[model samples]
Target: MDALQSSLLHQSALSYAYPLYRNLLDNSIVFLYHGPITPDLVVDILSLVENRLDDTGEDRRISKKLFNIMVESFSLGEDVERGHAVLLVRQLPYLYTVAIGRRIASSAVYQVKAFLDWVNTLSPEALREAYQRQLEKDDPRNLSLVGGVPAISILDLARKSHGILNYNFEYLNDSDTFFSLEARLQKTI
Candidate 1:
């Protein structure tokens, strides 16, 4: 066999592969997407995640809830690329964690931070109230481009899962910020 072929079967190569394999078995990975964000791309990613969840025998109700949360959070961009983004879905023994990362304009960082801060402070009942309020109002200014209430679904999902939404914004030079949010869905869901 050629060196390239032989190397593929070598202990050294297998050693490097084993950790990732073991991790997959221990903590299921639901989905991962890292690219320029787009509407079609979001739909495609969700479809793939749905199929994988089915294979793993995840509950349909929980799957749907998770899917809704993902769609609301990830599908908010315009047709044009809004810079590169990353979405990672991991299933652990105690929780399912979704982490999304994207680049945002430096100016909007405070707005996002304030919004997240308000969300983080809300209790489950308070979140439900806020979500209801958003749904009741149908003003053009309040409507999200993707339909449904903006940020309401995220708050509802977090409340339902009894989960936490943690967000961070790191300054990337003068004009951009690297924004990331990690949401944890409890195993009970």
Candidate 2:
């Protein structure tokens, strides 16, 4: 990767203990076309990370690094790619039948859980993830993760985690058919 790319990852990695930080990264990735990154390049990097239509056939370190580059680059400059990034992710089907759709939900679940565990062990004073209002929006290279797990699972995990964390997912069930994994736990616990 390039020097600019490496720097973003280095800064964000300091808060790797928090899902909010990763969420920040995911948020930007969800919309790579939001800053210096382009739609075609965003998809190219995302395809590497997501194993979507990429031909790398290997690890996605480049994509991951590019994510950091996208965020940090924009953070240091003005935002010119956010609109395109937002549009692309907004158009993706989180619950569709495509390869990304099937894995996104499960992968989202894993990313959320991993982030939670990581933060649980950290001293709250040492970090800050998205607590309220919105998720990640500070950095540019972070790249939002529009195609994580299904919205159902993401919302379920968020709501279930609310009491334990500062973020909440009350609006998750905004969809009539949506439900959290906590719904069952709420009854049992």
Candidate 3:
């Protein structure tokens, strides 16, 4: 009877996990990481992603854009040490999507949402101009500014992705919210 119960538990776990496994496969996920973001981990992830992009023979420009977006996205989180984040890279039919999800202080949710919304409305040229303006006004070297508010890195990501930045904020509690940002790069001919 105990053996049968153990088998049933294993089957149930498999049943729950199969769909998630299938979803990853269906999404053409090239890279997926869910953990504390560290400097060394970022380097390793970038190296793996670079190799994967090369192996797939992705267009040079698109790969570079994706790489830039990943770097910017990873750095957007001002308090990465305080939360574990998820980073996913997937290939779609027309473009490659790089997504980073992290938890942020609820106080900054409005600023992040506003910034992303404004960015989404900009044309490529306007986005580039915004990037330049922010670069001039803000110190890009200091990523942790304004108490976890994403500064120039967000603008750089918007420009690198050609304004194809998508973001969402989910309220987790009174003090923290889940922030998801996605940047898409068009596959060039």
Q: Which of the numbered candidates is closest to the native, going by highest TM-score?
A: 3
lDDT of 1 by residue, 1-189 (tens): 999888776757667688866775666765667777777788888888899888889888878767776776574332244566778788887677777777767777777777777878888888888778877774657563221114655565566556568877788877777777777776674
TM-score of each: 0.72, 0.21, 0.83
Q: Where is model 2 more than 4 Å wrong at Cα? A: 1-104, 129-143, 146-163, 166-189
Query: What residue pairs are clashing in model 3?
Result: none
Off by over 4 Å in 1: 1-30, 76-81, 138-150, 153-157
Write down the TM-score for model 2: 0.21
> Model 3 over residues 29-117: C-alpha lDDT tens digits?
87888888878888998889889889989888888888888988888653556578889988889988888888888898877777778
As for lDDT, the candidate ahead, 1 or 2, is: 1
Q: Given candidate 1, what's the lDDT at residue 39? A: 78
Q: Could you give candidate 2's per-residue lDDT for residues 72-149 as a string of tens digits?
A: 222212224212112122112221010111111332444555654444454433223332212434234453443232
Question: Which 10 consecutive residues of model 3 have the lowest summed lDDT?
Answer: 140-149
Better of 2 and 3 by TM-score: 3
Candidate-wise lDDT, in order: 0.69, 0.32, 0.79
Q: After superposition, how far is residue 13 of candidate 1 from its true place, in Å?
A: 16
Q: What is the C-alpha RMSD of each candidate to the true structure, in Å?
A: 7.2, 18.8, 4.8
